[model samples]
Target: MRPRILIVDDEPQIHRFLAPALTAAGYDPLRADDGASGLKGIAVWSPDAVVLDLGLPDMDGKAVLEQARAFYDGPIIILSARDREIEKIDSLDRGANDYVEKPFGVGELLARLRVALRQRQRFPGGETVIRAGGVEIDLERRLVRRDGEIVKVSPREYDLLSRLAQGHGKVLTHKELLVSVWGPAHVHDTQYLRVFIGQLRQKLETDPAHPKLILTEAGVGYRFYSP
Candidate 1:
């Protein structure tokens, strides 16, 4: 599965830029607009990495970072407007994996995130590979192959497929899949799932009209074939 990155900035522009970039780079993007929600996202979601901003409406970003470090061992990259040397030093000392000043380039941010994930060894040991129907998912490598050839999938498609594939045989509820891929804000947006799931079937299923790899559990949700 691709890494899930939680972006804890209140700015809509930041989310717009980062979320797409993160997804295009094969990472799931989740958002929390303020410090409290940010903390909650980190605690509840357990994102693979974080891009946090220092100026939060509810509380200081430093507080969120500190509180997060208390239990969340994953990488946190501070993405704030505060570019002061002291701020960087303090944040790093307080368990931030790295710091990026605001108005930063999307490319640089992605590179930093990549480095943080590498350093943390997000995928530690054995290869995480999943096979269902004709599709082969390599979680650690972030590649989906069909008939021994890589299949290009959108970031959202990858995220949804990854979640379902990770769960293997278990049926994931609509709320669960919606929340994980589109964040809590879109928990009730079941229509989004329907469209994406159909798209996934088209790409992964030899016959989208009658899917075998990704199956629906009637009014419930979806499941990835176990064998």
Candidate 2:
């Protein structure tokens, strides 16, 4: 099946540009001009990935992102005109998997989309589950449990934790985690990592202050070493 990609932007030109590009890249393109309709499309079509624009006529894109995170676990790439550092960080922190500024190259967008899809395909036929220490992560089911108790996490938090877990003790650099979880444009946004890492430690670590599960590499990123 051709992967379905939904483009949620108010600009007609964006649709015109992306629909064809996505089709050329072997994806079924879906479109929505406003946040409400975009959320509806997510529920109805259940696209493999989403390209969201922050500037919506009816609502801010962040609101839509929050609602989508409630149910949708697929990759969501924010396509926004706002190029401010805080805006990108806010979106990534709010559960967006990636962010692209306006006037982005189609090639870059396609590459990012492919990365997202590739990450999704890592768990094939229920073969991708990670168990470390007292934590069990069911990738296919998107469930995380520690010591037989369910550990709830936001979408971004889950993504971050999964990335680290997948590394399997291999140190993932700051740039690597930022780009993989927050997109290439945010490779320099280390603060986003700090905030999310703190959140993850609070939830996953027995003691957030002296973390043991997610070991920090000081200048580098982090490693998930529960054993």
Candidate 3:
């Protein structure tokens, strides 16, 4: 069954942008314009996950979050323009599962929702064999395959590929990748990371010159496209 996701934001623009994206991602999206109706929706419908905004016409978003947490245990990802550390800390402390600053990418939000749902439900499989982008990554077996045929990759290359795949759809920083695969000492080794990334694309992508699976985030890092 498709998970019913409740979007509690007063902004018409946000609703217009997210509703279709949520549908495309296989979620039945519903909405509420104000805090009163949002709380009512939560009590009546009991959605699987919530995309909540910090601003509301009736009450502060923290109030809604606090009240909702008292009864609803589902994931609540706070979406707001407020980026202050204290505000984020407060929302999280009030039982928000995650906080996304406004003007965010839909893909990032979807990926975060996927992670939150998995953590809450403990969805089985794929942990052992992570599959995405027309390939299978058997983590337990430490193997990569496409079209049922094994693809040979160096240990370092495989490690990098698996790291990116595990983080599917999220942009990972160069420092993060360097530290995860090559250890903390190699955090500054950006060139080394780039070399391994190119190698992985060569082996996995249909066209290494124009990779779709592993995408470069320019100055940031890379994001592995799941589908």
Candidate No. with top TM-score: 2
Which portions of model 2 show Cα errors greater than 4 Å? 124-163, 166-227
lDDT of all the models against the reference? 0.83, 0.86, 0.84
Window of ten residues with lowest summed lDDT in model 2: 118-127
In model 1, state the lDDT of residue 208: 91
TM-score of each: 0.54, 0.61, 0.56
Candidate 2 accuracy as lDDT: 0.86
Order of quality (TM-score): 2, 3, 1
- Report residue 16 deviation for candidate 2 (angstroms): 0.5
Residue 202, candidate 1: C-alpha displacement in angstroms: 58
Tens-digit lDDT track of model 1 for 1-227: 98899999989999998888889999999999999999999989999989999999999999999999889988788898987766775676576766788778999998877766764463343548876556889898888999889999999999999988765344467777888899999988999999999998888888899988898866657767644
Pick by lDDT: which candidate is best?
A: 2
Q: Which stretches of candidate 1 lie over 4 Å from their true place?
A: 122-227
**Tens digits of lDDT, candidate 2, 65-174:** 99999999888999998987667667766777677889899999998788677766663334578887788888888899999999999999999999888765445677
lDDT by residue (tens digit), candidate 3, 1-227 = 89989999999999999999999999999999999899999999999999899999899999999999889988898999997766765676566767789989999999889977765564332577776657898999899998789999999998898887776454567777888899999988899988989888888889999998898866657767766
Q: Point out the worst 10-residue segment of candidate 1 by lDDT.
A: 118-127
What candidate 3 gets wrong by more than 4 Å, as runs, is 6-126
* Candidate 3: residue 223 lDDT (0-100): 69
